[model samples]
Target: MPGFDSEFTPITRQRLFAGERLRAIRRRAGLGQAAMAARLGISVSYLSQIENDDRPLTSAVLAALARHHPFDLAAIEADQPTRRFAAARAALDDPVFAGSALAADALARIVEQQPAFADRFIALHAAYRRAEERLQMVDEGLESGGGRLPWEEVRDWFHEAGNYVDLLDRGAESLALRLGDGDGALRDALAERGIVVATNDDPATLRRLDRADGRLAISAALPPESRRFMLAHQLAAIAFAEPIAAIAESAALRSAEARRLLAVGLANYAAGALLMPYERFRAAARAFRHDIDRLRLHFSVSFEQACHRLSTLQRPGARGVPMFFCRVDMAGNITKRHSATRLQFARFGGACPLWAVHEAVAIPDRIMTQLVETPDGVRYVSMAKGLVKASGSFARAPRRYAVALGCEAAHARDFVYADAIDVDGSGAATPIGISCRLCPRADCDQRAFPPADRAIAVDPDIRRIVPYRL
Candidate 1:
């Protein structure tokens, strides 16, 4: 009886890759061990040896040998590149460095150390490419898209995990450091660990550390807030890499490299949060009556940082104003958001044009307020404001945004930003949903992608304000 081989299996292919063919092919040829040994000019024991992978059929043996049976070398090599591609792909699967060359470089490095992780990356990439192709076809079938596009999977992974709060909490409790309001505390702590802190350059853009020079220059590009963030983040990474890596390694994550990177991100976020704990800042913020400008004075944190930290106060029963915070720039791009309350800032595409968050950038340094709601009747009082990162000296320095907060409409009276949004208006709250796929609103100009489930009707009789007829 002839034995049949499965289409694919890692071990089978790897064996053939390692040139283990003597056992099967010689047997199929009905050649006994001694005869096969004579034909290959090797000892009978040597023939047995190569078959068991105990000794290599070195290039010399392979060149002199010939298969006395039917087989297809081309068919066997067909899946070889796919195997290598899978490894290369696995090495590059990094969420932090997604959409950049960093992922590819990371993958190459992984190939040098752990090839299995790299192989998994390749398999995942192939699956992703196929899924995206199918999704595009689905979009084409819709003819046109309107409202928030259904990019739920991409959105949640990129936006939610990238938010840094969860990672911060995990890393902070593990470090067991005392967080206080003093600006010098972090620098002093790092110094105790032989880490010298200097205001040489912004930490993010500083490429490498010159061990010989004993100098740590910051990037002149960063704003004060970003400077503190990058510095604290790096310090945290140095302090907690081992423990964080341990957590990541044991996390049962899809990829091992992702676990390592998550450790870095988690460490950085923890460092920043440790420099500014929730309880202390929340208390100072209340004393100032949630006045962001004044809170920045008390704690050397930026408006956005102060505002963002405020939203994370999920302490039992002593909760603060349960606000939704957003940080945006002049172009209406929502750089980040931390929300405990329901404020629908588009997780994909552009935000609603009618919303004050988009308009706040235009009215620089002025607070823009609005009353918004989702279709299911969750109302919010949102405050949007622009933030200028660099002052007069640093003209080339980038601009940023600082939209302090929002909360349930019922709590609007306590916030100064909700002074005039008219939450009680009978008109529909401009239909907003999470991402385009989840949002069913038709013809919203803010939509970056069309809703996945929108039953868009086209009559051509009336022109919709949005570019798409959906």
Candidate 2:
């Protein structure tokens, strides 16, 4: 009674009859016109008028029908001329429909006349996007001359799984509990299985596993964290052999090489999980407010390891703030990527240059933070730090990369990097796009290419920062 208004406003006067939706609902419910009219608390003649579009449905009748009948009101509302016309117009704006641009009235008429065709067009556009991504991957493989390499297949497999392997995670957590925490405990566990763990000063080999001789060799030149990670990776291979094999076999990869790479990836995932147990790490993350430095010190893991572990904190009931993690080399190639958030990385090219991750490359060891907004209007508080992994010799160059971690603005309160920034304030956020080619912004000077979905206009007399007007 409180929500239902007795007097209808002028806005309600525009109500058009959704006779088709009403008839469909009635037929699905298997109710005759008389019974439907009785249930809706309306006279049979009035119901017939509503069904035949001879009368518009009023507020009182709509409320009565909602109270008595089970129907999707949202679906019925979407059938309104205004909403349907808007959807059709948005679809027409797609680059696929570029050459055949229709006037607003024309598009609206099409939606009104052929709604099924419009819906199918939207579905076909979505399918086009999926196919485009696959094509990009194929092109990359061809450029590399490897014909879709095994490592790329494994990477795509992980991407499809949301970057979290539940079976491997749980198995690793159980193994960690049994082996206990700390490097000493891990060493003792390995030793008990007749696997002698020893470190060698030779920089040529990072890690070597001899199964027949039951010996594991690690490089002494490597740092404590790296050494520990390598040892844990080996332990995963030995301890969870059956589970890892089952997961690899179930993948049904085209080549044995891909399956082997997948097994290694699963082992690496297991090693990360073992190094930082989920519950303990999540609680510590909350306590530290997700400060990467403090987390690395507490867990005795490297900065990259800490960030990678944070991305995998997607357990069922207990979960951490969803974050996107990525590593970009000096060449701007994204070597690793995973997102538990809505933010998706560009599959083909480098990340947006305006992002803080690129800046981190110039300023090593310092963590850079920026509040960035995507083209879709979602804001993220991103943090990045440049790292150099020494090759332990002057003859070889150190591996240079910048690791980036971020979460959506909703999780800003939990992220330490967002502490200094005002996320809610206007004009304080940096506008970033998914990629230059896919971005819709026209005036961006940093844009390397024009948007694939939009038309460009070039004038010799009128030149701006960008040559073409989009």
lDDT of 2 by residue, 32-94 (tens): 899778766778998898889887665445444433331234335533544444445544544
Count clashing residue pairs in model 2. Answer: 0
When summed lDDT is taken over every stretch of 10 residues in candidate 2, the lowest stretch is: 1-10
Error in Å for residue 384 of model 1: 1.3
Please give, for residues 170-278, the per-residue lDDT of candidate 1 as tens digits: 4564443454445466566666666665554443454234456544455655666666666677667767767666655665455555665566656655754665665
Give the Cα RMSD of candidate 1: 23.0
Score candidate 1 by lDDT: 0.54
- Candidate 2 C-alpha error for residue 410, in Å: 0.9
Q: How many residue pairs collide in each prediction?
A: 19, 0
Please list the Cα RMSD from the true structure of every candidate, rounded to 1 decimal place: 23.0, 13.3
lDDT of each: 0.54, 0.76
